[model samples]
Target chain A: MAIEVRVPTILRSYTGGAKVVEGSGDTLSGLIDDLDAKHNGLKGRLITPEGGLHRFVNIYLNDEDVRFLGALDAKVADGDSITILPAVAGGALGFAAAAALLGR
Target chain B: MTPGVPAVGTATPGRAKSHGNVRHVLTIDSAILDAIVAHARRDHPDEACGVVAGPAGSDLPTRLIPMDNAARSMTFYEFDSIEQLRVWREMDDNDEEPVIIYHSHTATEAYPSRTDISFAGEPGAHYLLVSTREPDSTEIRSFRIVDNVVTEEEVNIVDATVDA
Candidate 1:
């Protein structure tokens, strides 16, 4: 069975506003490649020519971080759930909050 | 997939609570943010975000705090504070300041969204943005906030990791 891919609200436009997608693969990276093949715009939006995960974009496999794992090469299984996340910043006290995150 | 898909929630809101010692400032260098932006861009098929730590004083040493990218493709990041604690220890051991929280915008420009501004927690910290809308465009920008004021800074892309 193919695993289901979920797109977050911000990236809905790339997927034609569909929050969920379907694909077949044994690893997270494989599944994304398959999806990208079907969606060129998604490929442009997601992948850089260097083949590394986008800094602004984040990926999760069953709630575990792919970066700590094997990155895009991380393996997946049937019925696995994939999610795409992008990092954003901006607010009134946004600058203060961002500073708080910076530590010593 | 929590970690499989790069989501918005995982963008580490890199904030370090004020230790109240001489009102010191925390920070992460442009090189570190460059590394993060590069990583996100490289992984554009997915989203990427994380925490970069170090110490503040006359001198600073930047450290990478590998946390969760929780936004799930929503152009945001919610870093794991628990994981951040561990990174804090590492910086403590090395005497550095964790001064930066950064994220990127795939297929968009490197500018702050309403949410990005509203979620600002730490004051005087650098807010780094990485955008990948244009293939040949330099999609990275930095910001600083204090007392509800936002200030943008020039990010220095040193090298691949340095540039990120």
Candidate 2:
């Protein structure tokens, strides 16, 4: 069985509105890469150019935060569920626009 | 509205059983409300964020913790990862939970933004927004954010101390 990855509403556009997608890999990074192969640009949004998870993006594996579980190096197996969410705080769109412009 | 969509006070499917099947109206202490407002005011222009922790299984918000917005930007807020880890660990040690996850909108009204709805990860916590847009008064509102759906709820500011 492939791992099930849950996509957040904000990033659903990249996945063609498919909430949950299946990918396979031995580790979290491998799974993300496998997903990106099918859904272009997804990995870029979740990972930084420096080869680390994006500061604003959080990836949870089976309700356990990946940060505390070795981040992208965390091991994965069949039937594991992954959840990706953007770190959000403060006001709504108005602030979001400003933050985007500020490159935050 | 969708024909079968649950109303504001109705419990959404998959809501944690510990919170019961119905959505309970959140009642916060007047002092706590004041403190949240004060924090927002103090951070004016920049959005302020924090959580009110309560005893585990109690659902009563009593401790007001004003956290630093790591982004420190007027438009965005991010809990410093290190600080978040420390606070969450402390809460676990104390057998507490973040009953209320709150933030301020320095310019917008007291409503969840699209981003807010998208980023709400705490399914069991009361998502509170305080609007400090007006100089004379602050507007505060509460909602339950589950599965990207935002449902506004009543905020009952009680006068007496919450039972421990």
Candidate 3:
């Protein structure tokens, strides 16, 4: 299945400045792997060595946060849109707090 | 909707100076601004969080909503999930959207941090930051965050009319 992914501006470098790209996978994790194959080092920026999503990265499936759904294991299908964004906050807030502020 | 402000993407580049310029201006009623400042001061040393809602797609902020800071830390703030969900649902039911998302910084300047830029999901909403570091003065700033690009904007505080 072809799933369209939206790349945030900060990570556009890995995608050669392409804002959106298509990848195939059955789960969110698989999708990342698929994209990483084409865009080297992309996965490293999103996922940590511990096999968990990086604290500073947030992945949203169809506008719903994957962390609230199933994280990297969240199911995906054709036409799904996955958005990757780094965890950012206004001022002193951290990743978790920033995510919470956005009501994710 | 703003009474005299033009909707974004509808304004012609050069013909509508007000429309073009207003895009970077956050117009808030003085009373509401004071309330937000009060909330920030009341939560001194801890971050205060809340939102201002207006008619959906209007780009006008008319309602003040003070949310509980679930994090309640001096350096961080988070809206209570359950409360956020309910508030969002209510806004949807009322055909309203969050036009302004605001929070306070207890010890820092009024600007978005890297984390804030990463977490900005609403391209149309204005992110307002209020710093309560100084006991005598509050520093407030507004910005538009789209795709992680943060652009500082001007804040125009309007006098609250009798009808308002």
Predicted structure with the largest TM-score when compared to the true one: 2
The 10 consecutive residues of candidate 3 chain B with the worst lDDT sum are: B12-21
Worst 10 residues of 1 chain B by lDDT: B16-25
Question: How is the predicted docking of candidate 1 categorized under the CAPRI scheme?
Answer: incorrect
The global C-alpha lDDT for each of the candidates, from Candidate 1 onward, is 0.57, 0.79, 0.78
In DockQ terms, which candidate is top? Answer: 2
* Pairwise DockQ winner, candidates 1 and 2: 2
The runs of at least 3 residues in candidate 1 whose Cα sits more than 4 Å from the true structure, single-residue gaps closed, are A1-104, B1-34, B58-61, B156-164
Cα miss at A57, model 1 (Å)? 23
> Which candidate, 1 or 3, would have the higher TM-score against the true structure?
3
lDDT of each residue in B102-130, candidate 1, tens digit only: 66677667777655765555453566677
Residue pairs of candidate 2 with colliding backbone atoms: none
Which wins on TM-score, candidate 1 or candidate 2?
2
TM-score of predicted chain A against the true chain A, for each candidate: 0.76, 0.84, 0.84
Q: What ranking of all candidate models by lDDT puts the best one first?
A: 2, 3, 1
How many Å off is the CA of A25 in candidate 1? 52
Q: At residue B128, what lDDT does model 3 achieve? A: 95
Clashes, model 3: 8
* C-alpha TM-scores of all predictions: 0.44, 0.64, 0.63
**TM-score for candidate 2, residues paired by index:** 0.64
Ranking by DockQ: 2, 3, 1
lDDT of 1 at B68: 58
